[model samples]
Target chain A: MNLIGISINHRTSSLELREALHLNRDEIVSLIPLLKEQIFSEGVVISTCNRTEILGFPQTEGLDVNSIIGSLLQAKPIDGIKPEYFTRFFSCGAVKHLFSVASGIDSMVIGDSQILGQVKEAFEISEDLDFAGSISRRIFDTAIKVGKRAIKETTIGEGAVTVSYASVQVVEKIFANLEKKSALVIGAGESGELAAIHLRDKGVGKITISNRTIERAEKLAEKVHGEIVPFQFLKEHLHNFDIIISATSSNELIIHADEIKTAMKKRKGTPVVLMDIAVPRDIDPDVRKIDNVFYHDMDSLKIIVDQNMQKRKEQIPLVEKIVMEELVGFFNWYNTLDVVPTIKSIRSFFEEIRLDELEKIKNKVSDEDFTKIEDMTRRMVGRLLHNPTVKLRGFAESGANIKEVLTNTLILKELFNLEDFPTNGKSDAEENHNSEGNDEKN
Target chain B: MSQTITTLNVLLPLLYLTSFTVYLYDFFKEQKAVGNVNRIILFITIIVHVSYLLALTVEYDHPPITTKFEIFSIIACSIAFSYFILELLTDIRGTGAFIILFSVVFQVISSIFIGPNYKVPEVLRNRLLGLHVISALLGYSGIIISAVYGVLFWLLYRNLKENKFGLIFNRLPSLEILEKLSYYAAVIGFILLTLAIVIGIIWLPKAFPDFSYFDPKLTGTLFVWLVYGVGITSKWIANLYGKKFIIFSLIGFIVAIASLIVTNSLARTFHSFY
Candidate 1:
């Protein structure tokens, strides 16, 4: 079996190209059968917002990369993009890439945890379509294990790697508990919505959303289970909130230093965290210097995000070590698969020769002598074949190079004149047939 | 029995020291596995502590409250017991290091100062008095823990207000949780202290006809009770909370500690049996 992968990620492609090539759940499901027929025996398609990877095990060697890419592009065609934009990996590299991707190291946001779930969903889809067989199953399962291990054993997935999540983390650092804290989200934009959602997820007791338009604020509030506040009342009620996240599209500053100072005066020294996660910032920068007012703009949040990213990057070697260990385990088990059929073929070839010799000698002797002779020959065959069988198993268990084992297997087969042996070795069937023939003959 | 008590005396302190170290390690390292290990160590320490107290009771042929050393041992056990229950209920292991360190200190002090064969006074031999003393010790344990929580809350609140996002900020529970914990512990302390004082008052004349109502320990007890009473009542009725309540609880505990020390040192009260 030959594992193969083709990927187009944030590092290799532009956002437009990635979007053009992106596959949804339905698209991925439709592509599964085509991928199997056009490229490999088993296939899995992992398509997330940041990356799209088609990983499979080819049924045969010398499969054309261009042809596989052509098939994929044909299934989901994008204009003006060549197959060269996608990066390809062969067997070991393919497996390692999948493991790394599942572990979130290859994600756009290095330690974002969403990629693991995406990978699982992709694998489940492949499983539902019967496109993933035992090898794919083992690979996906091992990838998931590596993902969980990377999260559990190391700090790769520890901190928030996004600005929105970092804002919530800042609140967590300041307040230590969000259960009793209230948050106000200004401007109903994506970043503001994300911040509010994160605060809600962290169990912040109350959340209010305010936008220039009350309808938009109400919509976002409904989504985050927060109450809608009119934009005019935002500054007036700022003292009531412990955390304030502002992400508006307005060019001018929405919250000025004077208003914040007034709010602080009313807060009676209770600290308030203000996160301005917007371009051209929604809050005045001078407000950060105010006492009892913890103000962080996008740059400050970016510093936290960058620090978290750096921390996760430092854990790459550790995660890579874990992945390498898991790879060795998988390869060892896979090497055993390559040797098992060869071992069986050798055993059956010897068994057939012994049975043919026994048949020739059966009628040449008296009944009692024939019985004793047959028993003796059977014991001799067993003893003679035992050492080579044990040695072959030892070679397999020792995790020797698969190519060397296959070469040795070929030499053994040639030396035994077993060239006519079945390519798909039906060893179990032959063993059963031999035993039944022996019983009838006796 | 005496040999077993001796063995327990050494074993319990060593166990408590190990628990203290584990909790400290967990506090700094912040690993889930280390936290789990700390929990198990603390649990084992508590079990051994209870066993030691049982061995002491067996050796003395009564509850082990006859000597200052025995009372200290009970105090140490009560602190650990209350902390263990809090940990179980809150699943907050960050405060374990501080609480367990205090327990170790108390156990060490008890072991060093309270000898194995101290004499019991005639006035303290009454079972009711023993109950009162044990109840008061447990109550003091509750108050002490509440005071620690109060201190942590103030430290956290101050750090947040100052934007000092340091170790204490990350490790301790949130301000609201700490405040609630302090309030709960203070309530428990208050109820137990009430029980101790009431029992003391009802049995005061029966035990000692010459016992004065104005004795230092009794008067000190009443004063601490009134302080905690005012604190709790203010929190409930007058919306006194946050830093105000935290400061009140800490002051109340400090007064209680002062009462204990002054009454013991001055020997102007019959309650100072040691």
Candidate 2:
């Protein structure tokens, strides 16, 4: 029931290392059996673009990281890399790391919403391969629940976390509905094309792509199902579009204040949003002074992105609280697994003594008196065992130090002379032999 | 029965104040749980308000529209009811703070100035007049809600334009949703106001042969109706929307409020039952 993990994420490894360490679906499937044979009893591997984590339950006291790494290299070998590139976590730290990763708090983009599905896929693959045991399955299930709870209960996923998405959000703030609005992309460059695609996805009715070259604009317009407009006609038809995204490479302003003024008149007081995502600036900054015109550049869009990022960061503590609470619940349940068999042993020991003493007196008593005496002895045995059973369960749930609870359980086993009690259908003699071997190894 | 009414007089305002506080907190905090609590308090407040009105009707043996206090109470209840439906439909709770605040003020005023033994005029006791008053008050409530939405639209519009990204910008609905809601509310208000005017015109001469068409309240009501009518027509026909529509609704609500104040305070019309 000891958990261990190794993580290589964006913070700990370079992109090249992460790419090299990443496990494909086939590689993960092939690696699970080797991981179970060499390193752990059960294991799961979560591989995404930003991170690669291998979590496992070890059969022994100390985990051999090199054996796990050796198994991974056997699946997919790399030329030159050492084990130091991967950060390792044991037990509680490992569980917490997985929880945070599943909750999307540890993602490169906070609350990106893709990591949870990745974790679930990893767990499913492990389960299919018969590499996941009861403990690992419970951990993954609880992690998934925590992830969904974080999303549903908080505003962490409310706003756009990227600049391209933020551009659409800005347009949404001005116009109530994008369904009736039209957009114009001033350049067919990467940023401009991304904005156009986002606008299309947001259900903007019409999109027109404009560039100095009609060929590139035509290509982009075809992809987004937009109309191609000539570069020269940009100012003439600016009034027809409710949103304008400009990301040209021009060092000079492509759109001027006077041009927007003329377009505003033709627009008849309708609002227009102009986004300038270029470096040297595309739309004239002074055009922001016009009435019914909302002009934002890369810096302003970044502010929105930063604000959304900050909001998600603020929710990290709340998500962490939920994760910690779930972890406590899980560990409490796990602790009871250790105490349960012993409690059963002690109860049976008391019942056996009470029954033997009752049998010895059965032939010496009348029928009514025999029944009464039997009932009284049964009640005494039940009362005598109730407090100890309650206390043992309380200890398990109290989240006390696990080592101390284990020591107490061993003491009870010796004191009650119940070392011969079978556990998990294993004779006490075999269990003792296993523990002695583990102690000798330690 | 009297003790029950007295208890409600104290209980209703306190409940409204509690709801107002919760809504205001939710508006600023934007927490989902706080919003749920605010809605629950508002629902309870509406129930208590209805009970108070029903008890008053039972006590008076008539509809509870014969006094100034009763009219204001009904207006507050109507606004709450309308807002509840809108909230249920749209899931927009940010504007509840403003609407509930207005209801609290109206209810507080009604409770403070309530008269126990006010009598309905003989001619005004007809069911038609009661319907007229109720429709008029409901219409006014709708317009007031529309005006609140209009203000929110402008606030969000300005915040987005300035790139301030302040609390209001984060909390309020998009400008388009607010504009549509305001437009819908104005349309409802316009139809109800039209009904009130029609019923008044039909019942005026029968109730008061000496009723003058030149009465200030009558002209004021007509003028308010004309404003909303023109606003809605412009929005529907000319595609005049956004800031212009919001401004139009705000102006109409302001005029309606002015007419109400003038009719109650200065005009000597029979409509001024208060």
Leading candidate by DockQ: 2
Per-residue lDDT over A48-81 for candidate 2, one digit per residue giving the tens place of the 0 to 100 score: 9899889998777766877777777788788776
Please give the distance, in angstroms, between residue A299's alpha carbon in candidate 2 and its true position after superposition: 2.4
Candidate 2 residue A196 Cα shift, in angstroms, is 4.4
| Alpha-carbon shift of residue A201 in model 1 (angstroms) | 3.6
Top candidate when judged by lDDT against the true structure: 2
Using alpha carbons, what is the TM-score of model 1?
A: 0.81
Candidate 1: deviation at residue B201, Å? 1.5
lDDT accuracy of residue B254 in candidate 1: 90
Candidates' C-alpha lDDT:
0.82, 0.85
TM-score of chain B of each: 0.96, 0.96
Per-residue lDDT of model 2, residues B122-198, tens digit only: 77669898889888988998899999999998888777777787788778888888999999999989999999999
Best by TM-score: 2
* Candidate 2 Cα errors over 4 Å, as ranges: A13-38, A58-85, A125-131, A185-190, A193-197, A205-240, A257-268, A339-442, B61-67, B272-274
User: TM-scores, in order shown?
Assistant: 0.81, 0.83
DockQ of 1: 0.17
